[model samples]
Target chain A: MISLLQQEIESQPEVIARLLERETHHIQQIVAQLPPFDYALIAARGSSDHAATYAKYAWTTLAGYPVALAAPSLLTMYQARIRMAGALVIGISQSGQSPDIIAVLEEGKRQGRPTLAITNDGSSPLAAVADHVIELHAGPEKSVAATKTYTAQLAVMALFAAALSNDPRHMEETQQLPTALEATLRLSTPIMQAVERYRYMDRCITIGRGYNYATSFELALKLKELTYLMATAYSSADFRHGPIATIENGLPVFLVMPLGATFADMLTLAQDLRER
Target chain B: MISLLQQEIESQPEVIARLLERETHHIQQIVAQLPPFDYALIAARGSSDHAATYAKYAWTTLAGYPVALAAPSLLTMYQARIRMAGALVIGISQSGQSPDIIAVLEEGKRQGRPTLAITNDGSSPLAAVADHVIELHAGPEKSVAATKTYTAQLAVMALFAAALSNDPRHMEETQQLPTALEATLRLSTPIMQAVERYRYMDRCITIGRGYNYATSFELALKLKELTYLMATAYSSADFRHGPIATIENGLPVFLVMPLGATFADMLTLAQDLRER
Candidate 1:
């Protein structure tokens, strides 16, 4: 029998396709309500936080609005000022029950800022406090790895962003993401065989840039959670600054390179990581 | 003889005082010339990136301006359009030689945004592109751990931020920082004994919040660099989101908690980590 994690990982493409096909109009209505803002504050945790990081780049690259990853302590601990007079605050979560994620939207509401909740559960506490909710609609994610849920979160943001920007090319790409994901599933046998070579692997670096930078963080977090491997994520360009020192002669570093404007830099970094 | 790391770690309060005493007028002039911005983009790598993280909270809390930690590849790798008009872009570095950091300032300049460089070397390439430079003046730091330079960078940003906001209490606190660092040195004996207790430990988590969130990342990086341990840093709020699962009974999770607005959250996170 196939592992639950593997099956969930393979479910991403279909899950994402369903998200866009069924929920595009729902997303469009929510996007229509949000007033344009100069900045965004995204609150999330774990895999959802990784998705927020991706949204930072995607929102910045496609829409010109800069995004900040919210440290919930600012709200919960210090009662630090939210300064959300005209900002868009987003909270993302898989379980939609994280108190920190819930509090961000609550604080956003108190500050009178436009608040949004992108979560898996429609009735989760996070959705309750949010001014708007876009449920992941990916169904229940039981495996601890968070495979389908993560990709679904990414799809939600991608579709939201594409609709907000009215970018047809991005919309088309979002529609085709499932087929690409199915192809990725077929690589499982080879990937499992490849993994067999590193049964005792201890520590490594994961690198990515632009859209895939979120992928690097997600992969690193999963590696640590599932396999107890020490995987640190870094931007490909940032890796050259000082982290290259950490790489010894045979230090295994993984690159989360996907075809994008950031691909060339990843290529250079990968080559340098191998050569050095 | 004291190790360079400890000596530098203990020099922060003094370095910060000197930075404020001598450069406050000059920094004030820079601040006077630059208009207030809604957001800030800080670009750096490694320990400097940690300093940037501190500045994110500091600037927001004190100056009420949100800051974004630039991924650098956003400029060099993807060449994303830096919608930086009227934005304050600050590039930080110790060596003043990181091509990625330099590229961020270059892009900032091209976008007609005000640029600032905080670096140890005033004559470095990063300075050449920046509209203004605040030299750390911590002198040569040959050690790889980045003890003095990191603290000095933190001090410089703090001073710059305090001056911009014209907050006297923060300025006074800045002046007293070095004395606190000296007092912290007295903890070395216990710290060393504790290190001896964890000789075989390979993985751990470092937690912090608000002003000292950056300290978590810096300490984690140093632990990985000097001790070859896998240490990951998380904000107290963010840590509770998902990473708290990794904590088992007796797991070694180091915290860089100092007395501040975030101290209470650190205490709560400590209890959670210990309980689970």
Candidate 2:
């Protein structure tokens, strides 16, 4: 099954390539249409939401755009006072049909804010309402669980961030996504092997910081949805205050690392866990 | 802060009563309009997503609708073929702006499926595309860490299932939700006090069954998100497989019991853990 999925993923390089090109083009268009906005309100759910979160960080850090992640319920129920006049609402979803997302986007439209949809479904309702639509060509995935589509969404969002910021640096990094995804797939074997070892674990804790925070979140979800494992995800930094009390010998801990300044600190924490 | 939250929640009975009437009316109307379909698909993220997972069980058992929980990535990236042409797509969100939920709703619209959005923001993008919107009247929850909205969503979904299946059994039971919530809130002091007692532990495991399965899952999420704790949630039945190997002295195990059938089983498991 893993090999089949890997094969399926490999066959979609062109789709990934096309999706990258499309997002790149759409990013340029969004940059050209740069609405006078103070911040970007990004709305997304599940893995797509995680990708949007990554976009939030990238947009804030790279593009100097203030971004806030909104819960779909807040936009739908509260009619909260959003300073919408100068805000760009970016709705990210693969299907572009979730009722809450559509409602939020429609509300954004009603409020006269420009809305964009990053999706794979061109004819999706979100696309219909979006001022601009960036289509992802991930093709069909049969598993009830998500895999390739998540990587694809991340890739597109990375490109979107690059285009929005008009930062060549982000663009360069965005271009490396497909290759990164390919390399990441190699890690899947190790991850799967590791998961199998702890498949029957009463509980598992996944920890990461910064961009990888959502990575841990998504990983925990995958374990629950697929293997029915009991797992939780958390920011490594937050673990010290009170949560560390939950950790004990023999409990499985998975830490996601990105090469950065925080790596040293995370390593130290991991070492501490090992010694404990 | 927790006490303040409890006070606020206790004061909301009148508000919850009003909201319950409105939600029940909306749920009835939507369920009447639902086309014949094989199963239901719930798409959501974060706390709302956790509520939806609980709803999945309610829909399956109460409404007799085989329900599938969808991550937005599947709809957008993996292209998982949603099984029913007339399937009900229920999108749950507090803000109603999650991008992926919108994408899924967009896809459902393209496929001509009925879409329902349960959200707090009626004017948000998610409500805009929804055929029916059940607005949660949980007021403006200001905490970045969700508490009221989560419970409110669960309450609404429970009522929704009761309405959909025309089973007033749970509806009558649900009327006690606010009271139950208050009682749960009262237990908070004791629970936290208990937690404080074991705060020195490095990790803990929470287990439950049936609908409480998701309860365990959400508990883990809350523990991690709020306290940054390394907590894991597991099914009571699945606990003994291999995860029990890690169970030993000093490791805290929290078990949630359902109302009846599974309650005894959970008690047995707790006893076993105590003995271990």
Candidate 3:
């Protein structure tokens, strides 16, 4: 029996492929229409926030724009008058119903700053409030745990990053991501076996760095939401700073280190944790 | 015999008072000397990172400068070119050590952006690279878990917030903060009694929002570093988004709700958690 969650999970490659194929020109047009901005202020919650986290690395690295994750409570609750000058305000949401995320875009619009929303629902209030809307087009996400929308949001961020960079290599790599995701999904059988070993695991920590920092948080959120596990995510460097003390004899620590510039540091931490 | 951690914790009021009295003018001068900047990018690790979290809210709300906590790995591990134009790069570290943080300030200086260091050690490498330095005059901090330096860093953030605003009332309130700390410390006896109840607690989540969001992380870090408890911190808004499902019977949860605009929303979350 294919669970809706599993179906959504397996559909990621297709969803991302469709997203890139359908939205590449649209995202490029959106980027072209935008005014010159010095930085990006992104407002999101839950899995969308993790997408923003990925964008924090992606936008800064690829597009040369510093990205900051906005604390929506500052606008909605504290009524803070945050300086939005020279900022491209962005809101990322699936349903786009969250008032806090919407309030940030509204504030950005009120301040006359350019606002953009990346959401699954183009008709959502979040999209309505933004100067530009990048629809996920991942179709209806009914699993309630946000499996498809999360990846779709990441796809949108990758699209925006490529658009902003205007580099042929970046665009080619963006186009190839769905194939990479598809190949990655083929290893689920071994991953399922590995999960069997941790059937009784109640709590754990997820560690990643650089772009995968978003992967760490997203993984933790999925574990918490779907498995009802108390999973906390930390950057590998931050985990070393103090929480390394929390590691004992039999505790589980998940490290999300992809092969990249951050691999060596994460490998060192993994070796250290393994020795413990 | 009092534990070293307890003694250092008790010294927070005096440490903060000494910091405010000495560094207020210095911070003002640093702010005045700075070339006008559009935003602030801060880098830190461990408890110092929590202090940076406080400044993210403080600088945005009081000073009207959007604050972004920088991912140091971008500069260090990835060797990524980040646009630092119009950014006042600041690094906060008690020891002013962490090469990752200094790397950020160094890159900021390389990009011709103004840089600042908030550290207890004026002679450290971080201070050497910064255009200006604000010393946390909390004297010698011997505790392993960072008790005095955390509050002192918060004091420095408050002072900077006050200095940037140039509002006399903000300065007056900043001056009186140490007195408030002293008053709050009087509740230690009850807090001690409450601690006894959680003696067997192995894991918990700390929640806060707005300015006190930093307090939640600081408290969680202290718990992890000192008590070896698996404590995670989340903003109340973020908590409701998903991790709230982890709240089962007998699970310990800490909420840091300071009296402010965020109080009511926190109270609602508190009530929801209490019912659970």
For this target, which candidate reaches the highest DockQ against the unseen true structure?
3
Model 3, residue pairs in steric clash: none
What is the fnat score of candidate 3? 0.74
lDDT-superior candidate, 2 or 3: 3
**What are the DockQ scores of the candidates, in order?**
0.38, 0.04, 0.76
Task: Give the CA lDDT, 0 to 100, for residue B108 in model 3.
Answer: 90
lDDT of 3 by residue, A1-276 (tens): 999988999999989988988899998898889998988999888888899989989988888888988887777776778888888999998998989889889989999999998888889999899998888888998787998889888888888888898787897888988889988899999988988989999999999898999999888988888788899999998889888998988889999878888889999999999998
Worst 10 residues of 3 chain A by lDDT: A72-81
Candidate 1 C-alpha lDDT tens digits along B1-276: 977766676666667667767677788788889875667888888788889888877776777666777776565655566566546899998889989888878878988788999988899999999989998888778666788888888887887778767777877777777777777777878888978978888678788778888888888777767776667778776566455665666568888777877777678877866667
Better of 2 and 3 by TM-score: 3
Ordered by TM-score, highest first, the candidates read 3, 1, 2
- To one decimal, what is the Cα RMSD in angstroms of model 1 from the true structure? 3.4
Off by over 4 Å in 2: A1-14, A75-83, A187-196, B1-276
Docking class of 1: acceptable
TM-score of candidate 2 relative to the true fold: 0.54
Per TM-score, the best of the predicted structures is 3
lDDT of 2: 0.69
TM-score, every prediction? 0.87, 0.54, 0.97
Q: A210-242 in candidate 2: lDDT tens per residue?
A: 567678878877766655555767767556534
TM-score of chain B of 2: 0.91
Q: Each prediction's Cα lDDT score? A: 0.78, 0.69, 0.88
